[model samples]
Target chain A: MSTADRKARDKENLKALILQGAKKLFLEKGIEQTTIRNIADEIDYSVGTVYVYFKDKNAILHDIHTIGFQELGGSFTELFTIEDPMDRLRKMGIFYMKFAIENSEMYDLMFNVKAPMEFIEHSEKEEWNEGVGTFNALKNTVAQCMEKGHFKGHSLEPLSFMIWGVVHGMCCLEIRQRTKGVKFSKPETILMDGYHEFLKIIEKL
Target chain B: MSTADRKARDKENLKALILQGAKKLFLEKGIEQTTIRNIADEIDYSVGTVYVYFKDKNAILHDIHTIGFQELGGSFTELFTIEDPMDRLRKMGIFYMKFAIENSEMYDLMFNVKAPMEFIEHSEKEEWNEGVGTFNALKNTVAQCMEKGHFKGHSLEPLSFMIWGVVHGMCCLEIRQRTKGVKFSKPETILMDGYHEFLKIIEKL
Candidate 1:
């Protein structure tokens, strides 16, 4: 590899290390309590070095959210590679739940909490790609299903929101310990119920 | 007023005062930053007097949530007086949006954040009033539509969840300030889209 490529790789690795340490601290102490100094202490980096990498605590949170989205994106891509659109979507629903269950902290940051961090943008218009790539991924999959004629033509955005609202609402309650007295089916059951309902609606359209 | 009634009235009045003061502080400084002493100071009450009214800050939050729900329940009850099923439901959807818009802090406490305060149990497992009152309100209206032969024979709970899930998800996103670029159809359009689509499903059933 060229010298420039090697340097870029090294810088990416450092950023990843900082993110890992910061994420652990954020989950343990919460958004308000965790500080740059604490993250530096945990990672054995100097405070100045940490500052060189990130602007402030909120920057760290922004990076953490982006990284979470990246993971969730990968998970969706991995799970939805089935040749049939119907099969792909069914698997996508399971992947969505599995991703939530496995990455509770990051998942909360991505969807549950009011993420404190804001992004620097060039325009007044919405950059659907900037902070919303994760949700858009789900939307894209649903749109593809419709395009492939696996489902009838429904507004993919609202349908995506509906399927997400149910599953994400349940997941949010579970992660936050709020689903008291709720008659929960198995995780798979809950996930499939959303899938079945989506298919039912799709059939209507 | 009788002496006993006057005493009861004053007691209720004082509880409201403490909650108003505490809620103002909670919103201004957030939950963690707002202490009992700060609430007492905000209301110009002695710390001892504040304690007499509320055991702790959490107790105040619990009262806030209870009061919010009580008002919400009353709002829904008033909406029930309407005769047309679709019109009534459409109004109910508007009322839901109205409540969220008018009472931002209360909305946050009711749906997103759990109060740390103790809620007195008014409903046993066999008779959970909140869930029952809520779904029954929807069911009774839905029953009207069904009786009119608007919907054939579908279960109310699932239908209610569908409607609730859509409205709740929209409000949840709105309050979180996450719908930056997406302009909603007049609440009527979005609600009709989901509500009528739901009615269509019900009709098919």
Candidate 2:
């Protein structure tokens, strides 16, 4: 590659490295406790180098938030190969819940935390492309299911959203400790058990 | 009333007043922005006085969390008057959404915020009684529906939780700006529209 092209590539690689470190620290210690200095230390870089790449912690958080969506997309890779929309939708939720449970902190940052949204609000474009892409994928699957004569009397967008709510809510409650407050007969398996109930309902419809 | 009885009544009244002021500040500013000092100032009391009634901000948050449950219960008072378990269960979700949208900040504090949960952890009881009560109400309604031959093949607890997840997830998404991130075709009425879709699905069952 030319010198200028190599320089641009190096900058991109370093930015990815910084985000990787930030995401790890965020998962380990949570977003509130993790700092730019901590991120620099984790990546074995100077604090000045960290600031040189990103404006502030919010910038790091926003970048990591996008990375989370990418990871979620990675999980969905196997989902698209399935020919049946209903089956794909079901597996999609299973994958979504698995992602949330496995990466609880990142899921919280993506769905619940305010800093990433605030960063988007302050940015020039002010569009949540990552979120839109994720939602669209689900909406498309639901639309296909509708075409197959499943979900009669349902609007595509709202039905897709409701299904999202079911899985997301289960994960949110468990991650936020709200489930602990309620005495479930089986607290440990409530998320999966709840999901199965939803699966049963959708199969009939 | 006796002097001791009068003193008890006065203490209860002052505690309610403090919570009212604190909730106002919380709704107006936000949980992070509202402080004990802010609560005191809003109620025309001293910070020390605020502390005298509640140990810290978390304690106040716990009390307010209970009050949120009480307000939610008030909304459900009309629910039990309906005879059909399935109908009651449907309206319960509607009322729950109405409560969430109308009291968005309080809903966030009850479900998403960590402070009240932290306070419960530090307390002797170590239970989230308020959350328990709210979940029980929903569970009871679902159990009644099951008794009437609805959800014939589903387990009671998990189905109840999934149903709860459906409504709670929608509210959480709306409250946390996730709905805004996804460009829903009908952003303004997605919650209700999504819920109507759920209602359609369950009516068939």
Candidate 3:
């Protein structure tokens, strides 16, 4: 490779390394407690070097949040191959919940935390492309289900939003530890159990 | 009132005053940013006096979290008067969503934040009474609905939780500004619009 191309690739690799370190510290301590210095320490880099790639903590958070969406989108890629929209929608909810449960800290950063949104506010971007893209995937699936004569009396956006809300809410409650306080009879499996109830309802719809 | 009774009432009044001030500061600034000093300053009390009333910020947060439950419970009172279980359940969801949207910050503390739950862990209470009581109200309503020939094949707890997840998810997304990021067709009405979709589905079930 040419020297210029190698230099560009090196810059990108270092940026990814910094993000990987930040994400580790974020999950270990917490997003609020983790700092740029802590991230630098994790990756054995100077704080100055870390700042060269990212403007500030929010910038890092925004990029990590983008990475989180990319990961979610990657998991969702297989759902596109499912021919039946109804079956795809069901599996999508399951996959979405699995992702949220498995990578809760990242999921929290993507959906719940304000820093990423604040980053968008300060940056040139006018919209939350990550969030928009994910929501669109769900919306399109619901639209296809409607075209197949399911969701007989439902509007596209609100109905899609409701479906998203059901799964997201369960995941949020679980991730935020609200489920522990609620004392479910089967606490360990309540997330999937509650989801199954939703599946039953939507299958008929 | 007698001298002893008067002294007790005054003490309770001062404690309530402190909580009120702290809540105001929490709403205006934020829970993470607000300190005991800030709470004392808001109420014109010394920091030591604030500490005398509450051991720490977590205690204050727990108290405020209880108060949020009280407010939510107050809104739910009228729903019990409705004879039809289905009607009551429908109205209950509306009341829950209204409380969530109208008192977004308090709702966040009640459902999403960790401080109040942490307080519960460190305290004598082994369970979240506020959460249990509120959930029971929904559970009872759902039970009645089942007895009245609705929700024929669904289990009570998971179904109740699923319903809770739907509304809570919508409110969470809206409060966290996820709805804005997703570019809903009618951002202003999406919460209720999404809720109405759930309402319609449940009505048939």
Candidate 4:
């Protein structure tokens, strides 16, 4: 490879290394508690080198947020194999729930935290590509389901948004500790149980 | 009234006054932005007196969290006039959404913020009374719906929790600006439209 191409690849690799370190710290101490210095320390790099790759903490958070979505998408690879749209949608929710429960801190950064979003707002892009991309996957699945004569009489976008809300809301409530306040009979499995309840209702539709 | 009764009444009134001032400040600024000193200044009470009424910021937060629920409950009073359980449940979701949209900050405190839950965690109660009470209201309405031959074959608690997740998740996304990120077609009415989609699904059930 040319020198310029090799340098470009090395730069990308280092950027990934920095983000991996940042995510590790964030998962350990939460996004609020983790700092750029901590990330540098975790990655065994100088703070100045970290700054060379990211403008600030928000930049790192935004990148990590993107990675989180990518991970969530990666978890969905098995869903596409399910032929029936309805069945695919069901498995998708289960996979979505599993991703959220397992990677809760990453999930919170993607959905709940304000930093990554604030970074988007201040930056030039002015659109949440990660969110839109993930949302489209669900929207597409739901649209397919609609074509199969399920979810009748429902508008596509809103119906997609509603499905997103059902799963996301459960995860948000669970991660934010709102579910604990309510004291469900099965606190541990309530999320899956709640999704099952939703599944039964949607199956009728 | 006896002198002792008058003294107790005055104490209650002052406590209410403090909460009123705190709520106004919270609405004007935000919970994090509004401090104990700001609250005292707003109410023209000394910081020590504020302490006399509330043990700390969490105590004040816990009390305001209760008031937020009380206000939410007050909005639900109209639901009782509806005779049909399914219809009431629908209206309840609508009213719940309305409350979340209109009282976004207060709703965040009651549902999403950690202070109130942390207060519950550190305190002796060990149970979330306000959350349990509010959830019980929803659970009761859902149970009535099942008794009336609606929602066949669904467990009561999980069903109620899922319903809660649907509404809460919508509000959580909207308030947290996730809806803005997704760029919904009707950004302004996505929450209600989403609920309508949910309403369509449940109507079949």
- How do the residues A42-145 of candidate 4 rate in per-residue lDDT, one tens digit apiece? 98999999999888888988999999988998988878888898999999999999999899999998998887888999999879999999899999998999
Q: Which candidate, 1 or 4, would have the higher DockQ against the true structure?
A: 4
Model 4 DockQ class = medium
Task: Residues A1-205, candidate 3: write the lDDT tens digits.
Answer: 6999999999999999999999888888889889888999899999999989998888999999999999999999999999999999999999999999999999999999888998898989999999999999999999999999999989999999999999999999988888999899899999999999999988788
* Top-DockQ candidate index: 3
Q: Which one wins by TM-score: 1 or 2?
A: 2
lDDT, model 3: 0.93
RMSD of each: 5.3, 2.3, 2.1, 2.7
Model 2's TM-score against the true structure: 0.93
Best-to-worst DockQ order: 3, 2, 4, 1
True contacts kept of each: 0.05, 0.82, 0.78, 0.78
Encode model 3's per-residue lDDT on B48-162: one tens digit a residue.
9998999888899999999999999999988888999999998999999999988999999999998889999998999999999999999999999999999989999999999
Interface RMSD score of each model = 4.5, 0.6, 0.6, 0.7
Measured with C-alpha atoms, the lDDT of residue B9 in candidate 2 is 96
Off by over 4 Å in 1: A1-15, A26-41, A45-52, A116-131, A148-159, A176-178, A181-195, B1-12, B24-38, B46-52, B82-91, B116-136, B139-159, B181-205
lDDT for position A50 in model 2: 93
TM-score of chain A of each: 0.73, 0.94, 0.94, 0.94
Clashing pairs in 4: none
Error of 4 at B56 (Å): 3.4
TM-score of 1: 0.73
lDDT of 2 by residue, B1-205 (tens): 6999999999999999999999889889988888788889998999999888998888999888888989999999989999998999989999999999999999999999888898988989767888888888888989998888888899999999999999999999999999998878889999999999999988877
> Model 3 in CAPRI terms: which quality?
high
